[model samples]
Target chain A: MTSSTTESEFGESRESDSDNPSVTKVARSKLSIALAAVFCLSVIMGTGPGVLLVNRPESISGIPLVYAWGILWYFVQVAVVIVASLTVWRSTGVAESCRTHNAPSRPERNSAERGEGELPR
Target chain B: MTIPILVVLIYLGVLLLFGWLGYRRGERSEEDYYLAGRGQGWFISAMTIMATFFSSFALLGAPGMVYREGLVFALVSLNVPIAGVAIYLLGNPIRRAGKRGGYITQADMLCDHYGDGVGLRLLVALVGFLFAIPYVMMQLKAGGELAAVLFSGYDHAFEAGAIVLSVITALYIMIGGMRSVAWTDALQCALLVMGMALGGISLVVSMGGPSAFLHEVNQLPTSSLTVPGNTGFWQLPMLFTVCLLMPIGGIIQPAQWMRFYSARDADTLRRSALIFSVLLTGCFIFAIMPIGLGGQVMYPLELSADGVAPNERVGSFDQILVVMLDDLMPRLLGEVAGATLSSLVIVAIMAAAMSTADSNLHALSALFTRDIYSRFLRRGCSEREKLWSGQLLIFVATAFSLVLVLIGSRPESSLSGLMQMIVTLALFAVAFSIQLLPMTLDVLFIGRGTRNAAIISLSCGLLVAFCFTPLFPLLFAKESSPLILWINAAKELIPMHASAWGLVVNGLVFVAVSVIESRVLKARSV
Candidate 1:
């Protein structure tokens, strides 16, 4: 396998993305950090010790409190994922990267160019 | 009986058709066969990932757990979303690495990142082998259990059911590889979701709808409504740790890891994550959770000196769902209509089993062919030869797991203790798989871990986890041994899942080894 080119190229691309601090790059980083914060907080509240607050026989709108707590966290997690996908993931310039890295070597360049094969690396 | 059998036969035929289609569309390259050319769309990716993530664990095992433990499993259900978050967080990076490095299995990326070494590659493959076998065994066991419940009085029904499931799953994966597995998973995922929703609804309706159902649930014993449950097993610490770790372990397992590599793009995985989190979690909370709770209200456990056991009418806790469907459906919806829906749900349960079985079998084949056979046994094997070897491995692995499941199915067999609950097998598998977490994180993000650190930490973790498994004592010591007694005592005191224990030791060792290795390298440089 062409192991060296693959690892070095990927490593270099990742490093360069961090080194060149353009406005979009900085914003993307901030969004990613913020998104991570929300995700972590949600996990803590959703499944962690936060569950103790609702681990009871009491009902909310006729649903059991613990079950309701879980459902609430599920929605929070979904929102964080949706926000990350739309903002951070969408703006990662994955399409451009795919075109630069995969298009030249792959037989399916047309599809890559159309953003159908635009993966992270 | 005839209608349900007809439904199952039809379902099996559709699966074979999908397998043939995958073969016709596939290229002969190993990449195409193993990773589906790394070009799956969001829909197939989402469904396949969810289907493979779930398994008999979702349909039979989870409900069985809820029936056995109560509302504690409800909270454990939250682990689904954490797994969803992992798909994008861990998956995108892994996909990027796989695409860039032309990697196929978990061993590929890990070996490349840690500076490829034979020891590291073999250990990584060992993790995959250890994790996949028990998981595959559970799915096959689920098939036999389903048959035993459905076929009731038939001779050798359990054996026939398990063999059919193993043969069908192995044949498709052999014929079409990853493409067939993913395509069949898509169909199976759909069936599984429908089955969960319909099963929940049927149970609710049988108890006279939502308000009546909730009222009946509220009237049950307090043990059934709270944590530590009826059996007093899922205490707070155990629930929290298992909920936190198991999903991460599940996502990083061999099958799901390859699914990330198989995705068309980051966007496909992102969307897949969203769908998996929202849709599947919804199914769990609304659809699957009820089956177990409803089973309690419908069948009600018999509290004995041996602790809480399933009602006399219920064959076993895992059989609760099928038994409830058999008893309740015909009474509520009349014979023909009820039987049809029941058959569909039963096939859905089989789909859940097959979807997971095919993915794990397909992944195990890749691990063997790419990491072991081609790399060591045949240094310069042809692509055709590699593919053929992988197919052969799938058949052999399936048969091996089938034999284990058959043996364990016998009540007199010693292995029956390990096969008690589908959830127990799932946890046992994850204990090994979660051992991959620390090394995977270091390789993907931290980048400070040495090759030696990875190997040492992984070996330590696997050993620790193995010592905790039910099989460990069975193989090595009598239950009365001092070592076995101490281990059980520690487990009781800690109350965390076996995987959590493995991961704890794995993380600590990894950090210690990586720190010392780094310092030594720094001193050498100075």
Candidate 2:
């Protein structure tokens, strides 16, 4: 029963400056904001008031209109994620920020002391 | 019954073996116990997330709802993808914050961001615990109901099944911690997907073929084929509210929150999101929908104006999938193969239940130890002590859930279907969990509001949510509660889901209080 009081175990460094917010970072943030806003509106439109328009007895591809509309958005959401991940999210360097070995593995802990939860090497 | 029981027993044995392996691999630290040292690969992470998200509700409650309501609940099924979108949008930010802040539990992250002084830690922990309990209880109920069906005519079979499933899930989670939970969840996810696809296919083929199956469904009442659906329970407004709010509740809950923290990397989560949004969830909606619709044709319901009126003839809607598989699979596949396939499907359903149960119990133990006992009762307790405390809480929580299941299972129990009650309880859990949404958004994205606003908003939100729930009336004797009458009047006028009502109140209060408090602080400084 021991408490790991060392700051290293927590993966926090008061001195580290990984997230140096820059103009590019701000632009990326704005893009993320725009994407989030669009996503929310899509959800509301597709699932909310949109249900009224498509709530019909008509069939397309043998599927009812409402069910068809619902399924359409399922694909749309996936496409949204793909577009965001590939375009806006990739260039932000957040993926690189994610590679830091924050958790203490048995061998890794004993082997070295490096910055954790941050870019490696 | 014998074959299915044997198959399930074998499945349980394999889970136990995984648990033992998890124990061997586990280290003596909270990181290893709770987050699996954050080293899960993309595939494993994807499967675990999918499995934990689905649970018995997807297999049982969902199909039952579809069978009862028709196309309306199918739209409800679309919420899974909405949750997938939430994972991609909300999950990455939370993961980034979790890594940066070194937070494990939901409370850990929230308390870290908002400052723990104004009771943010305890409030988040309480909401999480409230959500986890009913979620765990429902999974336990699914186990018992599955057993009662498989072992019909056996006395105390339901109780035995519930207890056994609880013990096995708890043992594995306690032994290996998150590592075992994740690994077993992967196994469970595979079994779940295979079972759903195979089961759906078997269902379709038994009735003839795809065309024949579609013909049968099309011949049903037009209400079943349209929106507002057969039951009319999913009216446009209610449907809108449920579709919008429910997925938020589903993703932001405690277990899913921790999964975001435990991911190996952003790439892993992105792939996981792909599987979640497209592959797994897509398969689920496609596969399970046909089986449920087929159930309607097999056992036709008498439709009144609103929808399929509740008829005692059909018995429990929850048992539709189970009953259909039992009767149809044998006739379609041939005797031995049908029995074996049906047995595997039954085990898959059980796997769904166990996967969710283990996750919630594991999360509860973490929340109790880290957020409550360690934080308030004794700060700086050793990691080993906290782990042991968590293990102990798992047993206590399981026992409490078992008592509730037994009471619900009784002959003269006031509650209806065990599955239905479980579903209600899970929604109640979500009602409270959704209260955390504003706080979550504030922490993850907006970065506004003080601790006082969080505490007050959550408190008022839970109050409004409780009042809107059926429990509020029942607690006060439904006929005797004047407040119930008043609320009923209001509900009739508005026609909104309880969770939606709660969210509105919660959002308004959070914004108002935050604005007022911030202005007060500004004026004082001036």
> Runs in model 1 with CA error above 4 Å?
A1-31, A93-121
The Cα local distance difference test for each model comes to 0.86, 0.76
Model 2, residue pairs in steric clash: B230-B307, B231-B307
User: What is candidate 2's DockQ?
Assistant: 0.16
| Candidate 2 TM-score, true structure as reference | 0.88
lDDT tens per residue, model 1, B255-299: 999999998777788889889988998899888888999998888
Q: In angstroms, how far off is B489's CA in candidate 1?
A: 3.5
lDDT of 1 by residue, A22-73 (tens): 7657788888998889878877776677777876787777777776787787
Best by TM-score: 1
- Best candidate according to lDDT: 1
True C-alpha contacts between chains kept, each model in order: 0.30, 0.26
